[model samples]
Target: MTTAAGRTLHAGALLPELIAVRGIAAVAIVCAHALSMATRGHGGVPPSVEYARLIVDFFFIQSGFVLAHVYDRTWREGRFHYLTFLGKRLARLWPLHVVTLLVVAALVLAGRAAGLETENPHTLWSFAVTFLMLHSTWATSDLAWNWPSWSVSAEWCAYLAIPLFFLAADRVRGSAARIAVGLGLFVACAAFSELVLGADIVTLTYDGGAFRIIPSFFAGMLLRRMFDDEPALVAMSPRGYAATVGGVLAACAALIAMNATYDALWPLMVVLTAALASRAAQPKPGLLRGRALAWLGELSYAIYMTHAIVLQVTFTSAKLLGIGHTFPQRAALGFAALIATAVVAQAAYTLVEKPGRSLMARLLSQPRPARAFAAAADRTGAGR
Candidate 1:
């Protein structure tokens, strides 16, 4: 799908397995949030819940890798239109973001009208920050409307600066050296966050979110470059592929366990993300490439954006229907809420996300009538 500008748009590069990983990560996040809400600010959380926070790191790294895989050649060839790239990325992300933002706003208003005590009062400032995708740039403010959107805000920042990162990465010589530099920078950033900023990279808010994304994102880009330079690396035997996947999973589990005590395993998380993404890019027979998992991957963004709203609405409805406060009852309701979230997310993907993307692409891709007419007049004048 290369444009006239020599920009290659490789649709086949859409890695289904990686997409499945995204869906799984989204599910983990939903479970983590649900557990947090269920516990009502209690200290106890499953290891999975705590570990799920690292999934955002996976997202950052994956974004870098995927974008680089798709667009780096276009950029190198000088056909990468900044506005076009930004518009496409926004079209993919913004439709769902706006839909979910409005949904949350409506829910907040409805709750207020019914005299229900809402934890986060809707404010114009919060709305403005969220609508502009700037909520991840500051520390003091919170958008209770859609709390998880903070990451989307951070990702928006990344999308805007991707070209700059790509340009910087272009200057590097060898893929191995590039990867090493990226890893070193990532570790340095993590150390700075811990030693100087006195904040853990995992739980950092606002500005810290921006800091958290940079190293991992570039590391992903470097990893993608490595994949391109070394074909043999991606062409693993079935047994070797299985072992690589198993090794990464085992390492992740060990890191998650260590994180429970040490709290400084974020750099290791970058390595795991890169490894998983590199392997996932290969055409391999794996569970991640199954039809169901692939479909879930396609719906992942919708799930990630809408799950919080779904959970909120479900719990509110449960309360209205006099659901019991017992732990067993709450657990059952939570499971039901999760299932409902998936259904709603599927509907959102089918209804809002797909249509909105198509509409946006068509609108953005079309040339203005005025421009066309002016070009015609110029050609006519030249003929005379």
Candidate 2:
């Protein structure tokens, strides 16, 4: 059930499990995109090429749950100053985002300079939306910039909403209300997907439908609330805990069997992520541990931001060079490009991503806003 920390345990210690999972999930995401690239110019809807994106779905849900797992630690010492929270997120995201954007822009400009002929229509408008992170809506359309960006926007929104979600849960009378609110958010996301992305129940696509992703964040928020409330349920024996985790795995397999697929499967991914997080957070690690996973987690931001650009550049350059005969051959070349990209991504994380983020924080985080809950820690500290 519960651990020495009083928080319910799930699987083999929480922190290591989560860190391991994040790394695995990142690899899965890479695999999914690789599968997508093996096909024609674009990828969507085909059991093999299409369904791989479920990995990214897992990634999103993981984002929410991990955020919740760490939220208590941060807020325990301070109030929720909106500015600080937003600033920290910027510090986390903006550096990679801006640098990757500019680099992509530079490449595209370079291609244009070489008369490679690409597109950047609605230049001012697209640039503004991207700068503001409103580019998330592109998930609902044929447009995507630096392509993988949609998830970053969604992750940002989820972080901004987590505090409010926690506040809502703190004020709610029971788990039912909090869960209902989480479900309501899911329903809203579905409705948004239906209306904006126009995804019919009959059609399945890898479309970046924004509505489909909300369930991940909602699931995370719900789990955060549940963590605060369910110490008894969490304190089960190790065998029982293993069964519970097995059930979650079985449920995920069942979803695949049901052919729910991608947009249709977001809700399940949300639930899965929550369970995984609850289990993973059980065994918190000491500082400076899990160096490799932590490094991946850190470079994760850069990898995500730059991978799309890398893929596009690789593909377009290959096309321009008239390289490769068969899809399989090009696929091999693509793998090489991905490896090169990983190296570049790491460098970008260090040289550009980290620095750019720091610079933005310096710019956006000054003149700290005044708020009651903005203290460094919670006034009424409640440990699990």
Candidate 3:
């Protein structure tokens, strides 16, 4: 269904362009990590790839936007259970996390046995914290096993705050109020990053990073409100929407190529993501509707979750083979690793991630018989 405001609602209200963007972002992240691995111990990766990490904030923003679109009404109706919501989210995240952690642990052990070096942690404390998804909450100094899972942990933290976040968003009636809240959340986090972490907001990970996602997340939520209510955005033509998306992304590329500061890149990402989302709402979002893009988007989570393991294995193999010492060879290996990560992510999605999510929902989301019985009794009493 398409809203009067031009918002397209698919099953679960999934936004096509956003999903494709996610797929694109996931691949970019994999590419960045692979580049870093290939260049490990020698020097920095390219400046463009160095800033690819900022793409992670888009995930936060998308999460906030999509979740608000999907769940805000149910919440307003007073029937959205926190446990049920959290359980479903955990079901979505936990399975792949478990699989990746195990895979990384094995790789770490085997790499040690083979006298190959890896920077990933292997200590018991790190293991415990990562297993419990507490590593990003400052339970450890660095990420342990499946280091990218730090974002997953941070997402879990955001999930925990959804009830409060949603309530606050709902109470704030005016667009100005919502915008202020959104900007404040981001600015506060950025201020804290500069004061405490001595870095930009996007640079945080595995060091009180659980809170890092708040600003972008709220920005996404507020953007959803604008998408629904703003006249200029609502009346934008599909061609114009596409142009906005292309323009924002092109601007981002140009800036990155020019070695733009993180400060300059951050707001651009927000605009780029918003444009993609708005374009997805169009009835005919050319090219973004391709099956291949949709397939990648469907597998985006798995790709994001599983690629680190592939990178580690590829790096280890390169080390053992005594190759990839030069920049060209490392670039070639990184490209090859991207392809390998895609394959593994496809398998992980088809096998473990999808089924595990369904199984977890079944196990944790079953309705309580006692509550049902009590509800029935109350109805019967009312009739009597």
Candidate 4:
């Protein structure tokens, strides 16, 4: 590989801004869950937290873009191994998913045994299905054990379809065509969800979330293609970058002001992603590149995986202690839950996620006894 004058492939691969966005999304979802927990029997939560659910779409889109950026060139060069790619992804996702799933199961079982009512459906069959990462496709209920894991199940679906999405997008030539195809997929999926499923794409989780992830994931891959074709999108001056992001924000706000549907916000999301990505690509100061934010990004998956359990514990304890009723009490409880969520997420990341990934990497690195498979693995650099 011929290298660029100033950029290493590893450096180009890292997107601090997007990572920061992931951190923000993780925190937002935690907040939304916290509000829900606190307001279990109280008055309705604020409208803003209700809309936080849309950030899941952002995760789907970001996953597509980042994975494509990392592996597309290898695939195009005939050096991509599907199994190895899948293994690496599983290493990233499965450890924490299993941990959170078990934690939720124990909580539910203990609560039931103690004669306390639990809201989420946590049946044995559902647990087994979720353990296999098939909950999104196989479940009968929406909010089954560890409800947030639904997105992870949907993500597994996207990972399985990576080769297909890449091949499909690869055949479409030109930036405009790629954009059209990407948007078309998103719109088509949204349309099907509205017409047949009778739900907005954003609201589709557990039962119908696979449909939601497909288009968003494909669109994200397209966006990565466009960015590769024109890396200069990230070369804007500071003032220009600020103006571009501000304009996108204004457009998003206008959509909200008009009571526009969720589908209408899709393009703005794409634009905003591009803008932030561009700014992050630069060496200059940018909106989402601080140390704390980057750390949050690194801990994002842990936060997402563990927050539901932490919130459940927090709320349950609060209820037992007879708090979270009045406005001040709810606010304080929500704030406390948020802090505890972050602390627990950090622990999960340190204890479970990092070690599991390292172990998987080491296992994948061990020499294969089968000569033919080893040869193919070598050609593909899949062992790395």
Candidate 5:
């Protein structure tokens, strides 16, 4: 099927393993949020929870790879319609964003009415920023409503720059050169962020977070380019693919064991994402390609967007019920919260996101009446 950007994307164009990874990333992020809540105002966050923030970088990289895989060809052929592209991206992201923002707002109002303190930003300016998807820009702090949507906000900025990024990538000539340059750029950007900005890339907020996403996004494009140029890498045997995946998993285990910081593990993450993406292109039945993982992957975006809200509600309700202070109780409640998040995300995907996207696509694809009339007039004049 061709996307609104006029890019042809076959069903197989989507790599199942990548989808599975998305599911995993979504879960990690949710766990991280839940853990943070459980440990609120407490020091010593578990290393696993702390490192889970790198999943956002993985998200950026994956997005870049997927977008390039689907749209780069059309872009190179000069068929990419920027407005249509932006509309499609907005359609995909905005509906759930608005819904979650409203949910958070209502929760805040209820808390206030009950004489409870809510962490949500209740000001008009914050609402406007969240609605405009500008919450991650330098102009604002982290959004009070739908705090997790900060990544989505950062992604919006990347989506706006994708065309230009692709244009630059197109000029790099060879896939090897492009990949090399992309890695170099990533390192440079990481250094600048760490050294000059004096901010850990993983902990970046505001405009700093926006800067954090660019390198991974570009690296993802480079990975796609390399995959396209070198079929051998993706043509690995099933055993070889399994081994590569196993190695990546082992590395993740080791990182967790060592309690590596997000900064220490991000480069490894980029390499592993690239490697796994390459392996995913192979026609093999990997663990990540399992039905359960695939389902979670399909719902990953909804999960990412709604999980924080779900966590907050779950914890708040638990607190009201006096069920969360004890470790065992909190653990049980957290598990239940995860289940609830999945259920709610599934509903959002089926009822809101899918329909909203279809509607938006149809609306954006329709021709303007004035343009239609002008075209008809030109045709009539030609007939004369």
Candidate 6:
């Protein structure tokens, strides 16, 4: 779908800034994961781990926002190209993914060659699972692949459902009816998750991280629709912003008090964020709309896709230097790893993902020239 003004509303006017915040969420999740590994005992989680888990809810919310942006733009434009849209997504996401998968396989083969670990059925099975991107990050099993990749499974699932959303919204006609259907589909999907997986399975927890994230993803779709609705259902009115701030504090308290037990309140984080985005998406949010955050947002996918590998390489190198696992030691190690991850992710983005995106952009673009990537995104947003 292409926008006539060459400006398709993303995250309903918070496109770049919202994506910038996604960078912060990626950093938070990776650091929290690494720090929790240092802090948790063999059998149980520390209180800090609970804090870490809630942060993932932020990721789910962010995913929903992007998906909605994609779907709405596609439906509104009336000219979404299926092949080009999916192709762009593949170019943007799959290059790193397929490369990392092969890299893991190569590393495993090398580990076996060096006698670090023996090849066995269980080991081979672990490789097979991760090759499919199903290996859980928190599972006790010694496995491979990008350890943070369970979300990719969630991402692809959302991709599959997007066409269905586009059809419902575009074909269903009346605005209220289209919205009702979208919300209905979102709830039905959520109900299916609860019924099939149990209520506790909502926040991408346990095995839910593998598949149960559809609800959160769709909740994002619904919220995105709400953001675009004519009446401005969730725009940042002064009172609405105040309530969102209050709700965030409450969500934090519940997250802490529940000790990572509550996955149900995850949608609230998106609601709160959309309120803030309502403000930022307005005419003047100044530095929030600056170049740095947008650059970070552009690189955010690389940071997410590469950070775990960076953490492993950083840790493996540190281990070679005989670093210990003391609290302060691990904290310093984590800090160093974050810095290293940022540098490597930037390099990877420049060398791999960015160029791949550019090639796809040029090839799949409308034959006529467009002014910028926003116009390009507007052209290909349906497929994106």
Question: Tens digits of per-residue lDDT for model 6 on 1-384?
Answer: 322223224543446556777777777777776676554343344564555555555676667667667656755777676666666665666677766667656765776676655332336666666554555433425434565666775565556556775654445554466446645654676676678756544444325564556555655666666656643543345566667767886877776676544544554666665665565544545444678877887777888888877776666566667873566676687788888888988988888777877876667665645467677788797786
Tens digits of per-residue lDDT for model 1 on 1-384?
322233222423666667888898898888887776565534457665677777888888888878888888888889889999988988888888888999888888888899986777478888878888877877435446787888888888888898889887988768668867986887688789889878777666565677778887888788777766665555545566567667767876776667553234555555555555545545446777888888888988998999888778877787899873566666676787789889999999999999999888888888789998998999999999
Where does candidate 6 clash, by residue pair? Answer: 85-383
For this target, which candidate reaches the highest lDDT against the unseen true structure? Answer: 3
lDDT against true structure, model 1: 0.76
Query: If scored against the real structure, what TM-score would every candidate get?
Result: 0.89, 0.77, 0.90, 0.90, 0.90, 0.75
Best-first order by TM-score:
4, 3, 5, 1, 2, 6
Off by over 4 Å in 6: 1-14, 40-45, 118-143, 168-195, 202-210, 233-243, 258-260, 360-384
State the TM-score for model 3.
0.90
Residue pairs of candidate 3 with colliding backbone atoms: none
- Residue 346 CA displacement from its true place in model 6, Å: 1.2
- Residue-level error in angstroms, candidate 1, position 121: 4.6
lDDT of 4 by residue, 40-104 (tens): 66767756456677689888888888888788888889988998998888888888888888888
Instruction: Say which prediction, candidate 3 or candidate 4, comes out ahead on lDDT.
Output: 3
lDDT, candidate 1, at 213: 80
Model 5 has an lDDT value of 0.79
Give lDDT tens digits, candidate 3, residues 265-365.
66666777677776655675468779999999999999999887887777668867898888888888888889998999989998999999999999896
For each candidate in turn, give its C-alpha RMSD to the true structure in angstroms. Answer: 4.7, 7.2, 3.4, 4.6, 4.5, 8.1
Q: Please tell me which model should have the higher lDDT, number 2 or number 5.
A: 5
- The lDDT ranking, best first, is 3, 4, 5, 1, 6, 2
Model 1: residues with Cα > 4 Å off, grouped in runs? 1-12, 41-43, 260-284, 375-384
Worst 10 residues of 1 by lDDT: 2-11
148: Cα error in model 6, Å:
0.9
Give stretches of model 4 more than 4 Å off.
1-12, 367-384
Q: What are the lDDT scores of the predictions, listed in order?
A: 0.76, 0.62, 0.81, 0.80, 0.79, 0.62
